[model samples]
Structure formats: structure tokens, C-alpha cells
Target chain A: MRLRIIKAYFLKEMIELIRTKMIMMPYLMPLLIVILFGYGIKMQVTGVRTLILDNDNSQISRKMILKFEHSKYFTTTVKNMSEKDALREIKKANIDAIIIIPSSFEKNSLKGIKTEIGVFIDASFPSRSTTISNYIQGVVMDLANDFNINSSGMININTRNLFNQALRDEEMIVPGLIGMVLLISPAILTALIIAKEKEEGTIFNFYSSPVSKGEFLVAKLSAIFFLVSIAIFVIFLVASYLFDLPFRGSFFLFWLASEFYVFTALGFGLLVSIIASSQIVAIIVTLMLTIIPAFMYSGMIMPISSMSGDAFITAHIYPVMYYNHIIYDTFLIGQGFNSPTNISYLLLLFGYGIVLFLLGLLFLKKEIK
Target chain B: MKIFITILLKELISFFRSFGLVILVIYFFTAEVYVAANGMEIEAKNVAVGVVDKSAGGMSKKILSNLHSPEFQTPKFYKSQKELSDAIYNKNIMVGMIFDEQFEKDYYKKLNPTINILIDSTTASQSLMAIGYIQNILMKFNNLELPVALKMHKLFNQNADTGLFMGVSELLSVITLLTTILTAIAFVKEKESGTWDIMLLMPVNPKIIILAKSLSQIIIIMIGVVLSVGLILFQSLDVPINGNLLHFFILTFFYVATTAGIGLFIAAVSKNIMQISQLSIVIMMPIIFLSGAWTPIYAMHPLLQYLSALSPLSYYIEGCESIFFRGTSFVDLLPYFGGVLILGVILYWYGFRKIGKLF
Candidate 1:
């Protein structure tokens, strides 16, 4: 844990990571990030296939029809048809829902009486259908308000959601992939660098030659981190220019954040690599720790908040959670990045990176012994 | 039988010695339990519901009241359409509603009255239920007098039980797959560790070693299986395990044998654990992804669906649902048994051949 020991270890770890293909990942990440973010979002909110059965064919009903068909929410298979026909269409999945305007609608309106428009929604995908329902209701009521249905009551709200726009699947996955790719690449490199030495009986060279662990690790991580940063920069440039994803924040901040993230991942990966006698244990242990957590709890398909207390608590223990928070926050949030927490997370990431880097160095001594 | 038993015992003894193997099991099962209980879910409880009432009339009050009712308590007091839209786009709210100014007039008039609901469809599902609940209340309030019937149609059945749906499929996949893969690796990793030859050097025949390993793990596996079942049950997941408990053991035994065959096959062929582990992952990922554990396999494209059908998990789940959810007899589950046994035999035969080549 001495300063020299730490620095020497950092150098060694970095050299090991660099010698392995871990150094190439940072550059590869942005391309992977873009592909993962740009292409993965299946946001098909259209072609919702709506059929309208206009019973009234009246002015008000026609207005309702106009609102639905033109508002971009409904791709119409609408017909002035029988209830039986509508039912058949519904069964065929030809329409998400049917809007029924009764025969008495216009008549009732003329008499200053109650008239109703019916809407059926397919709420199987509660997320999408609910939004669709609300959108339908809003368009109808806007026109109705113009018609002076002064008593329309708080109008029925319907909304339909097509696809997610807040964050794409690629965006969610790319950041996690950053952690995942680095996990294997750097850790394997770090382990093999050391393990290779051990396996071939070269540790005596390092010990006998006065090549301190601290210097070795620092040089190793720094080289890998620098190479990774270059990789990330290229990916970001391509992602922004080619993929049309908005790079809303400072490139420097992303670098700072990922550097911290990479360091921590690389550190733990290195530490586990050192604990291992062979390259095999190192790879399995690192992957087992990194891959599953990266996939499951990173707010991709499942929300971390929804995870039960224990799993939720456990998810935080992995560096993946922090990395995910930062990646999403920086990439998607687009909010000004001058906050104390953001700054702190960045620092904590770096701090852990350094600490774990040291831990790997310290642990390497024991493994070697 | 004795040879198989010998192989199994040798594998089990090797497993306890491998720190990585034991830890992986603990991590996998424990995490699965935690994920089933907490991580794997659809959450919408605190989702903001934005409402805009242009009417400012009597019905607005009623709609607001209804939204605020104790039985249907949801926060529904959003101000403007812009605000609501912004909230939704920003992922702040799950749903939004806009009642036109004439809402009061339409309800007061005996005319076709309508209300617009602008809903944030993200972070929520089966939203028509919420919309329908409101419409039903209004319909009841009006004594079913509205000319249009508020029919609620569900798009996809998100209402399908997550625990039952996920647990039953996953139980089959992870348990069968993990056990088989581990059993396969058991003897081989020890051989790599140089422990197998040491055991072979002792009084024990290779056959007895297999038996001891299989028998040794029987208790631990049963314990692991029970613990997993307990973890799931503890969360009140409420997935039915209606088949005979004894039948579970019987099915598991055959399934395990088949998986063990697969494991042995992997171990016998591979020079090292990494090779087999990588192979296991490659084999397992598609099976897990396609077998409808996390996402519906039927939901996948046709090609992927066919691939899913190829996985043993499809049979396992089909048989499991029959036994667990539908409560069918073991005879009814013969297809699953047959599939497992066939797969096992093929893998074991290949494994034995590979082992013969290596030794």
C-alpha cells in the first residue's frame, strides 16, 4: 500500500492491459455505442391500424373522424360499417381500437341533448396503448371544444405510445457495453500480463530487476486508459456525425467520466486477474462479475428501482451501476453538468479506480507469493 | 449404470474443491431470487397522470373528484397541455388528459360528448385499463346513459402473471442448463486441476468416483433447488407448483442426467475449463434468449421462434406448465422426458468418445 508500491503496481497493470487487446476497446466503444444506441430503439408508434365505424355520419361525427385520421395517431382502416364488421376487424387485429359514433349523435346534439363517441383501446402494452388512448382523446376534445360542447365534461383522455424516444435501447446498452468490453479486454490483459509472467516464470525478472509494481501498474493502466479514450473519441465522433445521435455534453466530461469508470472496472478486473493462478479463472471470475450485472440492472429492460431491496442493494455494489448512471446522465440528460453530485460521482469513480488499482497491485504480491 | 455413477461421483468431489464453481452457483441462484422478487417487474405506482380540463365547468369537478376518489386515488391535477406534454416527453409523467372546454356542454347537452386523454405511454403498460376504469366510473355516474359503450380492449396481455410466466420457464432453463453444464465440467476441471488422476491412483475405481460425485451433489443440488423454490415462494410470486413434489424429483433426476451427459460431453472434449465454459455460454445464451424466459419467444421473429423451439427449454416449460400450472401427470410430461433423455444420450456419447480420444 506504499505510494511507490501503488504507483509501481498501477504501471504494471496498465502495461499488462495494453499488451493485451484491452487497449483497443476505448476506440471501439463509440462505434459499438452508436450501433447499440442508434439502431436498437424499436420506436414504431405508427401503423396502429385504427378502424372507425361512423354510425351517425353527422357533422360532429365527421369532425371526430377528421381528428383521428389526420392527427398521425391512427392509420385508418375505417369504414362506415356494422358493429359485426367492426367486431370482425377487432378480432383480426386490423385495428387497435374502434371509435363508434351512434346514430343519435347528431340528432341528440341538435336537441341540446347528450351524445357520445365510443373508443376501444388495446391496452395489452400498457405503456404504448395508454399513450395512444390519451392522444386520441386530446385530439377529439380539442375539436369538440371548438364545436362548443360546453358540457363535454372533462373529456375522455386517450394516448398511444409508439416507441421510446427518451432513450434508445442502443443508448442504454452502449454505455453498459463500455463497461462490459473494457471488463474483459483490460482485465484479461492485466491478468495475462501478470499470469503470463508467472506461467512462464518471469516474476523473478521483475523482482530481481527492481521494476516496482506501482510503476508497472500505473504505466499499464494509463496506457490502456489513453488508448481507450482515443477509441471512445472516435466512436463518439462517428456516433455524433454519422449516426445522428446528439452529443449534448462536453467531450471532456465524457472522457473524465469514462476514465473514472474504466479505471474502476480495469482495477477490479486486474485485481481478480491477479488473484487467479491461471488466465482461465481470471476470465471466468471477471465475466461472471461483470456481464450479468451489466445486462440485468442497468435500466435497459428492468428498472433498478423496481428491483427488490436486496438485489437493488447488491446492484449498487458493482461498478456497473455507477457507470450506467453516469453514461445515461451525460449522454441523455443533456442537463448542464456543473452539479456537485456529478462532480462527486466522477471523483468517486476515479478514487475507486485508484483504490482498486492499488488493491490489485497489493493483491498481486500475495498471488505471486 | 456403475460407470455413469462413477463418473458422477468423481465430478461432484471435484466441484467442491473448485472455488469458482461453487461461487458461481451461489451467485446465480441468489441473484436470480433477488431479480425475481425485485428486479424483474413492471412499475407504475408513482407515475404522474397529467390532466387538463378546458371546460372549467361542473363535469370537470366530477371528473376530478372521480380521479381523486379513494378507490381510484391517482394524482390527476396537471394544468396545461404544454406542461403535460413536456412532462411526458421528459419522462416525468406516465399519462396525461385534456378535457375540452365544451366537455360540460356535451355532457349537459344530450349529444356525443368526448374527452381527450394525452397519456405518457412510457414506464406504464396496459394503460387502457386505467382509461377504462375512468370511463366505467363516468358511465356508472351517468347510469349507462351515454350512447357509446366504453369498451376497453387490451393490446397485449401485460396482465399475464410475470412471476408465473418468468419463474416456470426460468426454473426449467437455469436449473437444467446450469446443473448439466456444471456436471459436465466437474470431472474435467478436476482433471485439469490434476485431482482426477490422484483419485484414480487411489483404491476407488473410476465408476465409484462418478457415483460418489453424483450422489454427493444430489443433496447440494436438492438444497439449491429448494432454496431457489423457497426464494421464489418467499416473494409471494405465487407461481403454482401443483405437480407432485416427488414427480419434481423424478423429472429433475432424468433432466439432470441428460444435462450431466451434456456436461460430461463438454468436459471430455475440452482441454481446459475456459473452452467448455465459453462453449456453455455460447450454447446457453440462445437457448435462454429464445426459450421465452425473459421475453416471449413467440414474440421473436419466425426464424428465432424456430430456434427457440429447438431448445430443450421449450419442452421443459411446456411440460412444466402442465405439471406446475396446469397440474398434469408425469406420463403427460413424457415428451419433455424423452427430449431430455435423447439430448443427454447424444451428449454423453459424444463426451465419452471425446474422453476416449483425450485419455
Candidate 2:
């Protein structure tokens, strides 16, 4: 009898889901976010606009200037500007850094006297400034080494990047984005689905009828779970194919981990719906609980271990934090099913899903209290 | 005027009374500031590394010791390549290195023995920085006698506190998003509750209603901005607001006006709260991404870099940075401020038309 009721409820919910564009949103939203973030977020700082005010038109000075111009890291614009104009440009943020070559540059180099190349960087954005300084140092160092000045005890280091060989920021971000995409729509969709019944007074239909609360709850979970799974699958394929993200681990393991994550997110949404009286309230609560914490506390941008005190504890409790670790480990580092770190976090997420689901069932009432 | 006053007062009361929205607003502002202040660091510091030193030569020892400190940790010594790779797999270390046995012998013989390094580049930016640091150490060891020097001056932020800059930008982004979402939801909620139709049927001008609703939202959002900027940013974080406070506030008002206008337009088109929420996310994602808050605007592709100008959040971020970090006066920020004002007028004009037709 309960099975029949559950089946009836599921069919009704599915029909409603199909009719409304709301049902299609979970899939579309992730696709949109993936494309947007894929194109947008870049960590490698390039094309630093540099102005070189060379007073020394000497061949040596011109060579150094050419190196900066030739390099992909900098967009060098050679200007014969005064110190005042250079300072004004830096203040105005028209130029990121200024390379001033003094008239004595070539003379000092020829006489074996030490010459200082003045580099003034706009430090308003500290990260960019630091990168600019590093790039400048590299350029200058290459020039110094080209001089073939003999030095003692020269040891060369071969830096080889493991896993992400190219050190592509996109590789790291794409995996993290899978977690972000899943967290964004599913939780809110589930919360709104349940809260809509309550707000529109449709939930009372089950109270007046013989249909069990368990049937209703199961029906709702299955409907959302079904919709969100398709979205996750599409996102996974897009991320792997389009972004060239290597799926080093087993596909089944990745799918299993995603299912566990989706369940936990849905459980969180169900809990929010039970507490929230309106759709607006449910959305705000779900978003505040999910998006903010997922983005901030999860080891997406900042690694969980790097975070101290409350943030570490906060990361520990959130299910996304566990999945974030699992996804990154499995995808990038190629951790297998038996991998201890991957196994433990994935298990923790499963446990989180069960607990939240049980709590959601407990809070979901037959009558609007 | 009386109708505007009554509508504004009613909206204000309802806003304060919505405990859920209030808590969310408080949480978003406080958590954003707290996370921004604490966790955001660009420089890779204290990364754990595994070192396999077969040579144990003097040069290798000097290089290993130099690796220990702010950029990297005291690297755990390993016996073989397998153990180092295992450590990386377990994430016990972010990087692994194996020094060739003839490292010192080759150095003396001018046969440059390579110190083979394995870096887990999942944290790409930090790993890149770590490579730079390692290269720097090697270069210094190479050029012990050669005095090729370059003078570097970090102009504005002498200490180069990246967290401070991130915190300020994050605070502004949150304020813009929160205000826009809240204002739009406020209008959409009334429509969903059927109160909007009654107000339209009553003897009230649509213009007065629009003016009142926007005014209330702006005022409430300003309060949040003041709290976040004054108390959290200025005092708690000790982030410098180098420009004129009065000018900053005025510029902020114009920017808020632009966002509020966008919100009203979204609300006017949306039939229910659900649609409002969906539309808001769709609209907000690109704006937030392109706003130069998380990623630098200059880093984006040139076309996107140009298109980012359309997002009011972009202008605000630029204007805020100029005022806070560069200590640029009001005159210097005229372009950004003017952009906000122009955008604000156009959006509000369209919004007023759409909402008036609905009435």
C-alpha cells in the first residue's frame, strides 16, 4: 500500500517537475557556472603592463629592454618620460610597474662596477605586485647569466611538477568547481520543492488523505535526486572533455562519491525546508548554510589544513569539505578506492548524508505545526 | 510625498521584522569579512615537502637548509623515490625532491648536477611561487661572487598585505550582492503575498511606490556598508581607508543606486519569488565573476576585460581600491563614479517603466 502511494506521489512530482522550467534549472545552472568560471578564473598573472624609461640608449640597455618586451609575462611600452610622468602613471594605475634605466647603466657594466636597475611597482594589489617583482627578477637574472660571469659552486635544480605537470590553475579549479556546481542548485532546488508545498498549502493534501509521510518524503527526495544526478553527470563529462581534466581514478568510484555528495546536499536542503516557512526564507537559509560555507570553509580556495582554529573545525563538519578532498584526491592525485584519505572522507560524507536524512524525516510533519 | 513616506516606513518595518533575512544579512557581512581577513593569503608559506638526499653533499645540505622557513617547511627526509612519491600521494607533503648522489662533485667540476624536484601542482599558484623561491636559492648559490643587483620599490602597500586588499574587496562584493538580492526579494515577496496588487489598486502613484521601496532598500544597505567598512574593515582588520570618508560614502551611494536599480528590474520581470531567486543567480554569477573581486579584471581576456565595464560591481571595486589603497581623491575617481551614476539612471529609468506598466 505504501509502495503504491510512493509511486503515485513520485509520478505527480515528476509531471510537475517536467512542466515547470524550475525542474530544468538544476542542469542548466551548473552548465552555465562551469562555462563561466572555466573561461574567467585564471591564477597565472600575465601581460603586466610595464613602462621602461630608458635614459641610456646604449646597446646593452636596449638589449635588456628588448628582453622585457620579448617576454610573454610583460607588455612593455618604451617611453621617454620624466620621473614625474612615471610617478603620475603609477599613481593613476595606467602602468603596473616602471623600469628606469639610468644613463650610467652601460658605463657601469663596461667598467665592471655594480649598476642598479630601478623597478618601481604599484603595490595597491599586493599579489600582482609580488608576481611583477618575481617576473622582473627572473628577467634580470637571465640577463646576468647571459653575461657568462664565472661563479663557483653552481648547482642546477630540475623542477618537475607532479600530477598537474603544466601547473595549470584550471586543473585545480575545475575539480573544486564540480563541488561548487553541485552545492549551488541541488540544495536550493530541494528546499524550494518542499517549501513550495507548504507555502501554497498543497502539503495539507497528504494530511487529509491516507498517504504516509514517509511516502511523501521519499517521493520528494527521489524527484530531486533524479534531476540533480543528470546535472552532475553532464557537468562531469563537460569538465573532463572540454577542460581536458584527467580522470585518473576509476569512473565508478567518482560516480559513487558524487551520489554520496548529492544525497548529503539534498539532506541539508530538506532540513532547511522543514524549518523555513516560505520559499524566500528557505532559499536564504539554504544559500547561507550551503554556498557561503562551501565556498569559504571547504578546502576549495584555501586548503583545509592551512586554515587554523574555527575554520578547521568548520571545515570538518561540512560535507562539501569531505567531498572536496575526495574529488581532488581521486581526480588530480589519482587516489584509488582503497586510498586511505579518499576512503575515510567519502565514508564521512555518507555518514553525514544518513544523519541529515534521518533528521530531515524527523522534522518533516504530517500537519503544518 | 505622504504616500512615499508611508510606503517607505512600512517597508522598513517589514525588513527589520523578517528575522530570517536579518540573520542572513548579518551572517553574510560578518562571515565574508572574517573569512577575507583570516584565510586569504596569496603567498605560499610553510608548504610541507619530502626530501631524498642520496648525496648528503655540502651544496645539497646548504640548499635543503635554505628550503626550510617561510616558503617551505623543514622537509621530512626520505630514503628513496618510492617513499617521497608515497608521501605526495598521501598529501603528507606538497612537494618532493631527490638530490643526485654526485650533486657536490658535479658542482665543483662545473658539471651542474640537477636537484630533481617533484611538486604537487594542484595548488598551482603556490607551487609556482615555491618554484621561484627554490630557483632563487639556487641562483644565489651560483652567484655568490657576482653582484648583479636590481633595486625594487613596492610603492603603495609597502608591507604588501594581500589579505587586507582581499578583505576590503570581499566586503564590498558582499554588500553589493546582499543589498541587491534583499531589495529584489522584498518586492517579489509582496507580489507573491498579493499585497502588491492591492497597493496598485489603491490611490497611490507608481512612482511614489518605486521611490519609497528603493529608498528604504538603499538606506538599509547603507547601514550594512557603514558597519562593515567602519567597524569590521577599518577597526577590526585595521585596513587603511586612505581616501576621504565623505567622498567614499557618496560614491558608494551612487554604486548602491545602480545595484538597487538592477534589482528592481529583476523583480519587475519576475512573477514569483522562485523566479526572482533564479533570475538573481543567473544575473549575479557573471557580475560577481567579472567584478574583479575574486580575479583581477586585467587577467581576463581583453574582450571580457572590456565587457566587465558593464557590471556596476566592477566600477565599485576599482573605485573602492583607488580610494582605499591608492589614496586617490574624489577627482581621480570621477570616471568610476560617473560610470555608476550613468548606469544607475538608465537601469532605474527602465525599471520604473516596467514596474509602472505592471501597476
Candidate 3:
């Protein structure tokens, strides 16, 4: 664990990485992920292509149809088609939903008789369908209010979205995407680099030399960690400027937590490299471990609190969830070290880093098996 | 023909020889699908909510009581707005409610009472769904009886269970990823291990060799898909197959072939396994994003929506969902088939030519 040995190994690792042209991966991967997901993945389903069959053709039905057209959630086209044709359009996967206003709608509404407007939705994806259904109901409710049909109570709920004022999907997605990119790139880069040494028999140099295991592992981890940190910093700057993401919390605190997270990722990569027999196996194993959990359990798309049973436990096990919490709190909630919960998550991330690195050192054999 | 058979057999035997890869494939097809399907919940469930009801023992209590389990946790009673806001900031609660002292009086006097809802919208999907649920609950307290009622018929999936959808979607994504990686690695492995010259020196046609290698990996992937569909989708998750099973498999074969074409291109460019993985993610992420597996195509921007037509995956996902959920007929499935085939031929030809030049 001498300083000279560590520095020499670190420089060697850096030069080798640059020589192989693998250094570009950390920078390129985050840029690609940010561009792809930031612009591409949207939770808010808008511009729902809809077809309307106004069988009534009355002024009241026309006004009702106009409400659907005005709502941002739905883009409706009033066509002179039967219900059968509208449904056929839905089956072709051409349209998202169909609104059928019956032939006798105006007559019944004027007489205070309850009129039923049929809303057939394509519920293949339940979450999207539910949002569409809610939107339709909201439009219908507005129409009811317009008609002065006072059917329900007078309670008005004013929802104030707290953290993200506009409720922009990018505000939530970008922070989580940062966590995901950090996890995947560092882990994969370290794992593959180390596994490449093993595959090419370059690892025997370390085994045959006077370098200790702790010093060897630390030098490799730190060198890759330095590269990953710069890449993530560039990503942070680009994402903040591009998405107009507000940094509500302390930059130093966020930087510190991110470093811990990067260490955890690199250590996991080290563990994978130790166990993998070849470069191909190492890459696949790293992907299988990182990509799935990052998407599923990290609370990026799904909320951990709402998850039940094994999923909840699994989310707790991954360090990505902890980092996700820190990113959301600092970026969205604008909270820093003041909150006890935030501190605990930061500490947990630190603990994950130490544990993973220790595990890597424990597994790294001085001699070939 | 004899040469193609021999090469195909050689590829299959070598694939089986790699014990780690075999186990990786099996785990991906089985355990991976099961965990993702059972765990991922898109709909709101057990949302943590906090409440400060100043107008106690009146309609406020009744409204507060309506927030129950499954949709929400029993609302934690906080002392004031300050405490509740702190709870939200601490990430202790997702949604907070404040009912002022005038709530009950305002309701009785027909003076539209407003209940302030403080929501942490960082988790967009959950918060949005929770808002819808709260609105539905509050509708019970509304007095006006509208003359017109809207009846919603949720077609295909009646209950709107996300498990069924996620399970199948996960399976489809897994199929895409594995097909591309396996095919790319098959060729890249030869180059990495210094066997490329020997492979080129063989008397067999390069086309036959390429066809045989890719076909072997595709067969392996088909087996993985069958295992996933049987063990995870059908047996555990109960994803209903509404249309003919043969139609789904045929569609899957076309998709696998198209993706393998992309893999061929990746192998032609990369010198080793590291580049294969990196390049795979670079190429695959955009395809997956455009495919509407994670996000629906209709939800994308107009420019991206048009671009999705170039991605073969978009058609595959739509075609599969139609067969499984919409029960679309084979004749009606022609457009999807056409989309995949047209794209597959172009991509396959390009990749085939790129690698064939090396031989």
C-alpha cells in the first residue's frame, strides 16, 4: 500500500485505457443515455389519437364533442362513422380510444334524464389507459358543469405540486437517469477492463510483482473512478443546462454523495471482474446485474414505497435506490444535509461503497486459481 | 448444404460448451422475467399520505377516512401544515392534505370549500395516479348530480393489471437484447481468440458460414423465449394468449432475425467483446426507446413518432400486443409482418455484405 506503487499502477492503468481507446465509453455512454431517455421517455401520455362518433348530431352533442377536442390529453376527430367502425379502428391499433355519443343524447339531457356517453378505451397498457379514462371523466365533468347540471358536492381540491412546479417529466426522469448512467457506465467499464487483463494474461504481472492486493485494487478503482467522475460532471453540467434543471441543494453535498455512489459502482465492477472467466462473460454479467435493477427497482420509473413483497426488499438491497433518493432530494426537494433522512441515505451509500470494495479485495487472489 | 449443416452443428456445440453463458441465458429467460413482472407496479399502490385536518369530527373526518389501504396508506395525522410540509420534504410522505377550520362550515353553507393538496411530484406516475384516486374519492362529497353520465369501457385488459403487461414487455425486451448479443458475440469471439484467419481459410461459402452461425444463435434464443413464455408469462404471471400461438412465434422469429441483422453489423465493426457491449447499448437503447415497450409510441413527439417506423421493434411490440390482447387475426397482421420484413431484409443485406467482405 505504498504511495509510489499506487501512483505507478494508477498511471499505467490510465495510459492503457487511453491506448485502447476505451476511455471514450464513459463520456459517450452518458451523453447517449441522456439524449435518448431525456427526450424519448415520457410518462405523461398526451396527444391520445381518438375518434368520436356523434350519433346525436345535435348542438349539445357537438358542444360535448368540442370539450374532448379541447383537452390536451386527447386529440379527437369527429367522423360520421358508426360505433362498429370506431371499434374496428381501435382493433387495428390505429387509435387510442373511441368516444360514442348516443343518438338520443340531447333529448335526454334537456329533460333531466341521465344520458350515458360510451367511452371505449384501448387498455392494453393499463397505466396509460387509466390516465386517459381519468382525462375523459374530467372532460365530461367539465361538460356537466357547463350544462349547469349540479349533481355532486361542492368540494374543490386545489392540488399544488410541491417539488417540481410544472410537473415536467424530465425533472423527475433526468435525476433518475443520472443515477442510472452512473451505475451502468462505471461498473461496466471497470469490470470489462479488469476482465480484459485476466483474458489477455496481463493480470499475472500484478500477481508476480511486489504490489499488494489492496494497493493494486485501489489504484485500478481510483483511476477508473477519476475518469467516471469527470464524465458524470460533464453530464451534470449538460443535463442542468439542457433540461434547465435547478440545483436546489448544496453542490458539495451532491458531489460527495455521487463520489460514494461511483465507488460502489466501480467496486461492483471489480467483484464481477474477479469472478468472470472472460471479457464477454464479464460484460454480459455486468449488464444483467446493473441494467435490470437500475430500471426496475431503483424507483426511476416505479416508486419503491408502493412496491410490495420481494420487490420492496430488493429495492432496499441495491445502492442505486439510495443514490436515487439523494438526487431527488437535492435536485427536486432542494434539501441538503439538514434532513436526517438525507444523511442516512448518504451514509448508506458510503457503506455500500466500503462493503463492495472490501468484497472485491477479499475475492482478488494473488495467484491464479 | 453439407458444409452449412456441419458449421451449424459446430456453432451449436460450442455455444453449449460455455456453461456460464448457458446459465446466463436460462436465468434471463426465467428468473429475470419473473422478478420484473411481479415487482414492477405502474399503478398507484400503498401511496404514503399525510393529513392535517383542522375541521375534525365533520366531513373532513369522513373524507380523511376514505383514504384507505391499497390505494393509500391510512393518512398520518399531523399537527399542522408546517409538520406535514416537513414530512414531504423528508420524503416521509408523498402526498399531504390540509383541511382548514372553515371546511365543514363552508361545505354546509354551499360555499365551495377548498382542500389544499400538497403533492411531491418527483415520482410522476405514482403522484399522478394518486391524484386521480383522490379526485374520485372527493367526488363522493360533491353535491351536484350531473344529468349526463360517462360510462368507461376498458377494453382488452379489464382490470388494467400492469403485471400481465410488464411481464410480456420484459420478455420481449429480453428477446431483443439476447438475440443481438449472442449473434454479435458469436462472430466477435472468433476474431478475439485469433481464429478468424482459420475460419476464412475454410472452403465453405462465407454466406453459408454467416447463415449457419446466426441461425444457431437464433435457435438458442427461440429456446430461451419458449422457456420464458412457458415458465414466466403463462405459468406464473398468467399472461393470456388470445390469438393463435403459432402467429406469435412466427412474429418473434421475424423480429429475432431482424435484430440479429443489427448484431451482424455490430460484429463487423467491433474488434473485441468490450466494443460489442458498448456498441450494443448505443444501438439498442434508441431502438428500445422508439419501440414503445417502455413508453407508448403515440405519446412520443411527432418527429420521433415518424422515426419509430424505421425501428423494427415498434412493429414487433405492436404486432405482439395485438395478438395477445386485441386478438387480431392473421390476415389483419399483414401490415406488421410487412414492416418487419422490409426493414429486416435491408438491415440483413447490409450486415451480410459488411461481414462478407472480410471473408
Highest-scoring model, DockQ = 3
**Best-matching candidate per TM-score:** 3
lDDT of 1 by residue, A1-369 (tens): 256665666666666556553444444433543453344333235446678887778887787777777866567755867876665544333356777777888888667676666776644333445555666665654664565433423334344552224434344445455545655555554554565566557667776766566666665566566666566666556655665555555566777777677677778767776767766566666666665677666544444433445766877676666655555555655432654445666777788788887777776672236
Clashes of each: 111, 0, 12
**Cα lDDT tens digits for candidate 3, A237-280:** 97799988988987887898899999999988999998987887
Candidate 2 docking quality: incorrect, acceptable, medium or high: medium
Q: What is the per-residue lDDT of model 3 for residues B1-359, given as tens digits with 9 covering 90 to 100?
A: 88888999999999999887799889889988887777777788899899998884578888878988889988888998999999888777889999999888888887888899999898887898899999999887785667778888998898888888888888888898989899999999999888999999988889999999999999999999988888789998888887888999999999899999999999999988778887898899989988887677877778988999999999999999998888888878899999999999999888899888889
Model 3 superposed RMSD (Cα) = 1.7
lDDT of 1 at A49: 69
Error of 1 at A324 (Å): 3.1
List the pairs of residues colliding in candidate 2. none
**Could you tell me the fnat of model 3?**
0.86
DockQ ranking, best first: 3, 2, 1
Q: Model 3 reaches what TM-score against the true structure?
A: 0.97
Residue-by-residue lDDT tens digits, candidate 2, B13-125 = 99999887777777767776877776777777777778898885677788788987667778789988988888777666877888878886888788767789998788788
- TM-score of structure candidate 1: 0.64
Candidate 3 regions with alpha-carbon error over 4 angstroms: A151-153
Off by over 4 Å in 1: A1-154, A158-209, A222-259, A271-297, A304-322, A325-355, A358-369, B1-14, B17-27, B48-161, B164-170, B195-223, B230-238, B329-332
DockQ of 3: 0.72
